[model samples]
Target: MKRTLSVLIACMIGAAVSAADLGDDGLHKTPWMRDTFKDLREDLEEASGEGKRLVLFIEQRGCIYCKKMHEEVFPQPDMAAFIEENFFVVQLDLHGSTTATDFDGEENEQRALMRKWGILFTPTLVFLPEEVPEAASAIDAAVAVMPGAFSKGTTLDLFTWVDQKRYELDNGEDFQRYHARRIQERNNISQE
Candidate 1:
């Protein structure tokens, strides 16, 4: 009886360690992602109400890179908490048949939207400004877009940069510079 109890506890602990779940659609699910009606305008408004930035993640099932992000970087406590606190994330499947309304008031299946946005990869992150042009599609109005898998620091730095609205500044320190400086800052802190 004691051995069975120990085994059960072990399984539970393992589950907690790898918390990202595969949904019925075969896409990874995270607690921080918002399950909305897939309407960009409403999602943006809701995110603004909560004082968070709007981010759209375009991913497809069976995508190894997407799985890597879900199981690796996104599940990290700090990364997860930072995302939950600062961003309203909406996940749109690259091949999904579910209808999603774009910021331009155009409606299409998730797959169609992916093509319309000219996204060719999984794990593409679109960061939007606090306000977008009324007739612009999400891709056109995005302030920054990160494609493919990246290290934890790069991902965090991008999120931070967008959240801080550094893209809107006249300082001309773009994401590359910001990320480079952040890398140096992290290295220095670790060395200290």
Candidate 2:
């Protein structure tokens, strides 16, 4: 009985260590410093011309899920390749006091932008170049937001859905079904 108990305790310790590692790893052990808005704006401008969209990943320091997404999901070989090729990625900190002038010309700190943008939670993925010919402004307040954690499959599906402009009709169908079909299609292509 004592030997069995000892083995159980060892396994628990190993699991705890694995979880801790996942919680601490990110895109790099050092946090990514924010890029200047001037440079980012120029990059976004170029991306718009090329038909690539913006993907803003909102997170906070010390967030375990944020770390996991950056380390595990974003770094997945296929995921990284796809994101790098298709979208301009930006990481924003929700609690940060750094100022950013949004495309709307609203000058506010990051935290204030989070609130002004109606984001109540972390790990939100806000898509941009929100203008599309249908909207009045380049950044539409309503259409740019997608919140919360998404598994790898869902993340890729979202990018493809947005790229294809399927989001316009996604509202009419079951979102899960639509997203699943895209995932399956991607799998088949990748396998081929």
Candidate 3:
């Protein structure tokens, strides 16, 4: 009986560890998340140089939704590879004091910058275009903003849509239409 109890406890501990791989800041950490200097302009330039989109991932510590995204959605192989290949992700703490320089030459703490942009969500993703105007802030220059945690399908679809630049298409097939079509296409494919 003692051996069984010990095995159960060990399994529980393993599950907890696998739940969300957290960093010292308490935010969920992923292998694909970039450790940059938090300067949007420089980060954008580096991402451009690497031929990837600049993505600001705003998340707070102890957020269950953020945990879900980190563990359930982001760990999916396809999503991970897609992001690693096409996006340069910069992580920002929602309440952290780390200084982040905006594209407009303004420097502020991560929390203050998020407040200025009216973003109170824990896991907001601000996706940027290839080039941003010098006068615009990072939030102002965002081509797409994902407000919160989403399923792998929705998240992947958003990432794909932004990567493909479907937001700027003139065919009137916006994200909703694109997402619906993707859903239908996935449904039609046999999972043999």
The C-alpha TM-scores of every prediction are 0.90, 0.67, 0.88
Q: Which candidate is the best by TM-score?
A: 1
The most accurate candidate by lDDT is: 1
lDDT of 1 by residue, 73-108 (tens): 887766776787789999999899999999999999
**lDDT, each prediction:** 0.89, 0.59, 0.86
User: Residues 1-192, candidate 2, lDDT per residue (tens digit)?
Assistant: 633554455445532222113223232221222244623355467667755676677777767676666655665545554555567666666876777666656667777877767666667777765453332222353344667667888877776666666667636744567787777888899999
- Model 2, runs deviating above 4 Å: 1-34, 38-43, 130-144, 169-171, 183-192
Q: Clashes per prediction?
A: 0, 0, 0
The better candidate by lDDT, 1 or 2, is: 1
Could you tell me which 10 consecutive residues in candidate 2 have the lowest summed lDDT? 25-34
Give lDDT: candidate 2, residue 45. 74
lDDT of 3 by residue, 46-165 (tens): 999999999999999888889889888886655676777789999999998989998999899988898888898979999999999999998899989999999998999999899999
Q: Give the CA lDDT, 0 to 100, for residue 61 in model 3.
A: 89
Ranking, lDDT, top scorer first: 1, 3, 2
Candidate 1 yields a Cα-based lDDT of: 0.89
Off by over 4 Å in 3: 1-20
